[model samples]
Target: MTDSNQISVDPNTRGNANLIYILYLVAIVVGITSIVGLVMAYLAKGQGDALLENHYNNQINIFWKGLLYSVVSVILIPILGLGILTGLAALVWYIVRCVKGMQALSAGQPVENPGSWLF
Candidate 1:
């Protein structure tokens, strides 16, 4: 019997998934680079590629949240070094998790990232 819960996902697509995750990691390192990749990935969604769309959407959400939060923290520096410290810590953790998530994707598996909290 065919299980309705089964979804069609190619194991070989791990490489593609890895590519997307790498964008998130890079966003941590280069900042702007990740943002550009996120935008490009988002635009690629309308090309009729559902899997890629989902992948890019995940990366985009992560990129924007990290980027925005980091900027906000910097602005709050006047309140003391707490904001900056927390922001940097969170940013570092985000990058590490992004790398781990990429490894998961590269193995044709799923990962739980902060962005995944949305849905």
Candidate 2:
């Protein structure tokens, strides 16, 4: 149900969409950026949801976990030799995953096929 006063998305009202887009871009730099997008999207429910909040959150979770594991692997690489690849791989993979998630969300879709992601 909708109310008479709610501000829905119009092609003309590109402001909020712009904000969401900027936030999504920010996510690429630090996956945690999705948090800002999520909050903004939720707060703008009356203006229609950013529709990417959940996807952003999921991506953030996966990103941070991947980052943590990558950090650990990097720290262990000197002792474990050849393990540095794992950290680099994890970082690359997560970046790809987060990018995909943000893309899907921006398209007003849920990021369903992240491929074996834990969160």
Candidate 3:
């Protein structure tokens, strides 16, 4: 029997949360879609169960971290001429985080450390 205190996540909510990764992927092409995804993630965060909540937190971190990396990359563009490489590394990091989150969500599991900066 399921414990009364055990939280159960809705499958539909899980699917919707998974869509955030897709939005992150799409953001590669549209650029603005990540913003939309971030907004959606923030809105839905409050409604999630433990697992979904972890996914939301991971997604939110990905967005903010990516933004911070991008800003740093831009600032370094002229001074160090390393912005291109840094930007690409940031993009790869974002993709990896999204992919990893989606994989964990698909397995009906919470990420080991949602707030972690590394994948």
Candidate 4:
């Protein structure tokens, strides 16, 4: 009953995944948008093909891990001012993860390791 010649893809899921990545990137300045992205990722998880599902898991992990890193960085602020360097490093790490997610999504592939903390 299905067309074998046609590929099955949920465009909404793909678009939502892309939007989440963009929201995370925008959070660098806007600060609150990543929360929105996180919620979207959770809502969309397991609702798509394997590729899209992997993206959702990757995004979710990114949010939680990124938050943990940010908090650790902030807590270290008064400790020899180490937070400054740690915060910068956390920012770079967050950016790299988002970029890598976007790249995999664009390639129509699942994330190689959705649970990785490092890029």
Candidate 5:
């Protein structure tokens, strides 16, 4: 019988977390999977180790910032044609954040700054 008191850690935690970040990237193309990815990040929030926690935080940050920027872009859509450029920038920023987070997770490292505004 397995020891009930024994604590076992899953070796796939990092990879699983990385998959969420990958989903975020895919969502950029598919445009709907981001909801699933963000939900997974929230669901896994307290279940991961420190590094994974940082990744979750990073993912959450990206989602909120992307949403905020998108809202602002929509508001400015009729102003001087800047909204198109702003929306495109926000999309690129979201992709970069996801890619960087994935790279860090793949390297088994925590994000240096999960709440940073700049990439």
Candidate 6:
């Protein structure tokens, strides 16, 4: 009996994706793991099934977008005095994105919008 909702994700792909998500989460404290995860995502891109590929794309986008937000927030620190708030928002945003990615990956589903700027 086959379950139509069951998804068979490749073990290697799932493992790598899971690790990348964890690294992103740990990066909040360690700060270096995010870079490692970014590299992993780049290397793993286009090397998996469609669902895994979507996750890789989402992870890559998260890195670049997070960097942009961080930079913009820093730049606004002295100019507008809102940098701190923006920075905090960026951190929350990053965490949410990672959590969402992990959830989707666990369900064997592609990210809803891999390139979305907001969760």
> Cα deviation in Å at residue 38, candidate 5?
0.7
Report clashes for each candidate as comma-separated counts: 0, 0, 0, 0, 0, 0
| Model 4 lDDT per residue over 1-119, tens place | 98866532343557789989999999999999999999888877777888888999999999999999999999999999999899999999999999999999999988888899788
**Reference-based lDDT, residue 69, model 5:** 91
lDDT of each: 0.60, 0.57, 0.85, 0.89, 0.83, 0.90
RMSD of 6: 5.8
- CA lDDT, candidate 2, residue 108: 65
* lDDT winner: 6
Winner by TM-score between candidate 5 and candidate 4: 4
Report the Cα lDDT for candidate 4: 0.89
Two-way TM-score contest, 1 vs 2, winner: 1
Question: Native-vs-model 2 lDDT?
Answer: 0.57
Relative to the unseen true structure, what is the C-alpha lDDT of residue 28 in candidate 2, on a scale of 0 to 100?
Answer: 63
Candidate with more favorable, higher lDDT: 1 or 5: 5
Model 1: CA > 4 A from native: 1-16, 27-29, 46-54, 113-119
By summed lDDT, the worst window of 10 consecutive residues in model 2 runs over: 8-17
| Winner of 3 and 6 under lDDT | 6
Worst-scoring 10-residue span by lDDT in model 4: 4-13
**Positional deviation of 103 in candidate 3, in angstroms?**
0.5
Provide the global lDDT of candidate 6 against the true structure: 0.90
Which lDDT tens digits does candidate 2 get at residues 1-119?
86977654442243454455466457767766656755655555454444534543454456456657768787879985756777667767765665666566556676674435542
Q: Judged by lDDT relative to the true structure, which candidate is superior, 2 or 5?
A: 5
Residues 49-96, model 6: lDDT tens digits? 888899999999999999999999999999668999999999999999
Please provide TM-scores, in order, for all candidate models, with all chains considered together: 0.65, 0.50, 0.86, 0.88, 0.86, 0.88
**Greater-TM-score candidate between 2 and 6:** 6
Q: Which candidate order results from sorting by lDDT in descending order?
A: 6, 4, 3, 5, 1, 2
